[model samples]
Target: MKALIPTGDPAEPVVLADVPEPVPRANEALVKVEAFSVNRGETFKLEAPAPGDRPGKDIAGLVVQPAADGTGPAGIARVVGHPMAGGWAELAAVPADALAVLPDTVSALQGAALPLAGLTALRLLRTAGPVLGRRVLVTGASGGVGHFVTELAAAAGAEVTAVTRDAARGARLTELGAAAIVHDPADARGPYDIVLESTGGETLPVALARLARRGTLVWFGQASRTPATLDFFDFFDGPESAVIRHFHYLDADTGLGDDLAALVRLTAEGRLHPEIGRVADWADTATVLTDLRDRRIRGKAVLTLS
Candidate 1:
C-alpha cells in the first residue's frame, strides 16, 4: 500500500512509501480509500504520518472489515465523532463508527472534501441550535472554510454577508448565497448577528470590533498565516456592546459523527455543495502541498489515491 508519510520537515511533509495495510481491531472498518483531500492548514500542527504511520484527515471510501478497537458499529453516533486515519492511501483502516457513508449524489472527490470543512461549517451553523434568518458575516468568504460557512448560513435562512478580497470570485460568492459581497477587509457594516472569522493576524482585531452586541464570533481557522492579537476586553469591555466566542473546529468536539452525517445528508440531497479548487493525483501531492503552503490555491484541494 502507498501512503503519504510526513518527513519531520516543517516546510512541507513528503509523501512517499509502500507501507503495510492496517487491520481493524474492534469497532473499526477497513476502508478502500477512493479519494482524499489535504487541509493545508493542518501542516501547522501535525507533521505527517511517521514511517509506520498514515496521514489523512478528510476521506471517502468503502468499508471492507469491522472494528477491533472495542467500539460499536452501524450507528450515527460512532461514525461522525472520530474519523479514521490514512486517507492518502488506496486502502486504510478506520474505526467503523468513524465512517460517514458518502451519499450517491456526491462525487468521490467531493465526498473526500466533505469531512473536515463541511463538518466545521455544520458545527458553526447547525449544532446546538439554529441561526436561520439571522445576519451572518463570514470573513475570507472566498476560501474553502469561509465559502462553506457562507453556504450553510444562507441555507439556514440567514442573510449572509460574505467578506472577501478576491474580485474574480465575487460573482461565485453571490451564487453561493451571500446576500452581499464586500472587498473591504476592515470595513464592518455591523449589527452583525453571527460573525465567523476565518482570517486572523491584524484582521482578527478588526473583526473583533465588528460584532453586534451579544453577537457570536466563531474562529474556524487562521488562513492569514498570522496569529491573532487583540485586547479581549475591548468588545466585552463595553458590556452593552457585544460578546466574543473564539474557537477552533476541534475546540468543542462531539465525536465528529453527527456533524459529518449532517454534511453527507446535505450533499446527498444536493442541498450542500463543497467548493473543491484542485484535484491532484498521489504523485503530485508534493507540488500540491507546496502550493497550498504558499497560499497558491483558492478552495480546498483534493488528492486522489489510485
Candidate 2:
C-alpha cells in the first residue's frame, strides 16, 4: 500500500512511499482509507517522521478487517474515525474505540473532515459547560477546528462571536450562527463567558482578557507562530480571575467514539457542516501539506484515495 510519511525535515516534510498492509489487533480494525484531512499540528515538523511514521489522524473509509475479538464494528461498514497512526495510508489500523459508523447520507470526504477537528470543537465547548445564552467567542474562526467550534457554539444557543483575519471570508460564518464577525479580534466586545482560542501568541492575552469574570478560555492552537507572554497585571488586576484551560484531542478519554458518531450523525442530518477548503488525490500530498503549513487554505484540506 502507498502511504504518506514525513521526511523528518522542514524543507520537505512529507513524502509518499509504499508500505505494508497493517495487521489488526484484537481490539483494532484495519480500514481501507478512502479520504483523510491534514491538521495544522501535523505541519509543525515537531519531530522527524521516523521510517513508517504515517502522519495522519482523521480518516473516513471502509472496515476491511474487523477486530478479532469482536470489540470493533464489524468489517465492511463505512466509518469515520481517528487513527493514532497510519491514517495517511491506503489502509490504517485504528483502535475500535476510535471509530464510528457513518450514516448513509455522509460522504467519505465529509467524514474525513469530522474526526479530529469536529471532536476537538465538541470537547472544547463541552468544557465551557452549557453555552446556551452565554457569550461565546471563537478565534481563528475561519480555520478547520475553529469552523466547527463556531458552528457548534452557535447551534448550542450561545451568543456566538467569531474573530477572523478577513471579514470577507467569513460570510458563511454568519449562516453558521455567528452573531458578529469581526476582522480585528479587538473590535468584538469582550467579557465573554467562553472563549475558544485557536490563534495563540499575541492573540492569547487578548483572548484571555476578553473573558468574563471567572470565564473559561480554551487554548488549542498557535497559528501565529509567536510565543504568548503575559504581564503580571494581566493575570490579577481584573475584577475577578478568569480560568485558562488547555485542550488536546488525544486527552479526550471518555466517549471518544460516541462523540465521533454523533458528529457524523449531525452532519448526515444537515445540522453540522464540516468545511473542506480543498481536495486532492494522494499523489498531491506534498503540495497539500505545504499549502496547509503556509496557511494557504482557509478550511479543512482533504485528500482522496481514489
Candidate 3:
C-alpha cells in the first residue's frame, strides 16, 4: 500500500511511499480508501518535522472489514471518517466509533471533504447553542470550515453574515445563504449572537468586540499565523456577557461518527454543500499540500486513490 508522508522540505513537504497494510484492532474498521481531503492544519503540522513521517486524517471509502464487534456499517458499505493518522493510504484502520456510513447518493469526493472541517463546523455551531433567528457571523467564509459554518448557520434560521478577504467569493457565499457579505471584520454588522471565527491575529479582537450580550465566539483556526493579542480593557469594558471560546476540533469527542453521519445526510439532501477546490491523483499529494498551505486553493482539496 502507498501512503503520503511529510519530508523535511519547505518547498515540497509531502511524498508518497510504499507502506505495510494495517491490521485493525477488534474495535476498529479497515476501510479501503477511495478518496481523501487535505486540511490546512495537516499542512501546518508539516512545518515541524513529523515524528513518524505519517500524515493525513480524513478519508472516505468502502468497508473492506468491519469492526470485530459489529459496531458500524459493514460488508462494502461506503463510509467517511477520521483516523488519528495514516489516512493518505489505500486503506486506513479507523475506530468504529469514528466511522460514518455514507448514503448511496453521496460521492467519495464529497464525503472525503466532510470529516475534519465538517465536524469542526458542526461542533462549533453546537457549542454556540441554538442559532434560530439569531445574528451569526462567520469569518474566513471562503475556507472549508467557514463555508460549512455559513451554510449550517443559515439552515438553522440564523441571519448569517459571511466575512471573506476575497471579494470574488462573496457571491458564492451569498448563494450558500449568508444574509450579508463583508470583506473586513470591521464591516460586519455586529453584536452577533454567534460568531464562528477562524482567522486569528487582528481579526480576533474585532470579532470579540462584535459579540452581542451573551454571545459566543468560537475561535477555531489561526490562518493568520500571528499571535492574537487580547485587550482586557476592550474586552471587559462592556459586553460583560459576551463569551470567548477557543475551539480545537480534537477536543470535542464522542460524536464524530454521528455528526459525520448527519453531515452526509445533509449533503445528500442538498441542505449542506461542500466546496471542493481541486481533485488530484494520490501521487500529486505534494502539490495539493503546497496549494493548501499557500492558500492557493479556495476550498477543500481532494485526492483520489486509484
Candidate 4:
C-alpha cells in the first residue's frame, strides 16, 4: 500500500512511500479512499513532523469492508469518514461511528470537505442554541469552517455578519448568506448575540467586546498563530453576563456519524455548500500542503486518488 508519511525534513515534509496496510479493528471499517481534504492543522503538523507520523483526517470513499461488530453501513457503500490519522492513503481503517453514508447527490470532493470543517460549524451552532432572529458574527469567515459557520448560521435565521479582508472572499461570503461583510472585527457593529471567532491575537478581544447581554463568544482556533492577551478589566466594560466559551468539535455528546449525516443531508438539499478552493492529484500533496500553510488557498483543499 502507498501512504503519505512524514519525512522529518523541513524542505520536504511529506512523501508518498510504500507502507504496510492498516488492519481494522472489530469496530472499524476498511475504506478504499477516493479523495481526502487537507486542513490547516495538518499543515502545522507537517512543519515539525515526528517520525512515523501519518497525517490525514477527512476522507470519502467506498466501504470495501464493514466493521466486524455489524455497525456502520452494510455492503459496499459510499461514505464520508473522519479518521484520526492515515486517511491520505489507498485505504484507511475508520471507526464505524465516524462513518456516514453519502447521498448520490453529493460528490466525493464534497464529502471529503464536510467532516472536520462542517462538523465544527454544526457543533458550534448547536452549542449556541437556537439562533433564529439573533445577531451572529463569524470571524475568519473565509476559511473552511468559517464559511460553513456563516452559511449555517444564516440559514438558521440569524443575521450573520462575516469578517474577512479579501475582497473576493467577502463577495462570496455575501452570496453564502452573510448579511454584512467587514474587513476587520473592529469595524463590525456590536451587541451581537452570538460570535464565532477563530482568528486569535487582537481579533479575539475586539470580537469579545461586541457581545450583547448574555451573548456567547465561542473561541475555536487561533489561525493567526499569535497568543491573545485579554485584560481582566475589559470584561467589566462589556455586558456583565456575556460569556466566553472554548470549543472543540469532538467534545460534543452527539455522535460523529449523526452530525456528519446532517451535514451530508444539508448538502444534498442544497442548504449547505462546501467551498472547495483547491483540488489536485494526490501526487501533488506536498505542493498543495505548502500552499495551504502559506494561506494561498482560501477554503478546503481536496486531493483525489487520480
Cα RMSD (angstroms) for every candidate in the order listed: 3.5, 1.5, 1.3, 1.0
What residue runs in model 4 are displaced by over 4 Å at the alpha carbon? Answer: none
Residue pairs clashing in model 4 are none
Alpha-carbon lDDT, every model? 0.71, 0.85, 0.88, 0.93
Per-prediction TM-score: 0.87, 0.95, 0.96, 0.98
Pick the winner on lDDT between candidates 3 and 4: 4
The sequence of per-residue lDDT tens digits that candidate 1 reaches over residues 1-306 is 777777767565665788888766666677777777777766654555445545677877666555556454443222322354567777666765556766566677887887777777777664324677787878888777777878778877889888887766677878888888888656657667777887888876677677777777777677888898877676556324565665656655565655677777887787888888889887888778877777778778888776
Residue 199 local lDDT, model 4: 90
Top-TM-score structure, candidate number: 4
What TM-score would candidate 1 get against the native? 0.87
Best by lDDT: 4
What lDDT score is found at residue 114 in candidate 3? 92
Q: Model 2 over residues 105-180: C-alpha lDDT tens digits?
A: 9999999999888998888887778999999889889888878988888888999889987765578888888998
Instruction: lDDT for model 3, please.
Output: 0.88
lDDT string for model 3 (161-248, tens) is 9998787688888888999999999998787888887889999899888988878888888888888999898889846678888787
Which runs of model 2 end up more than 4 angstroms from their true locations? none
Candidates ranked by TM-score: 4, 3, 2, 1
**148-190 per-residue lDDT for model 4 (tens digits):** 9999988889999999978899999999999999999999997
Q: How far is candidate 2 from the true structure (C-alpha RMSD, Å)?
A: 1.5
Q: Is candidate 2 or candidate 3 better by TM-score?
A: 3
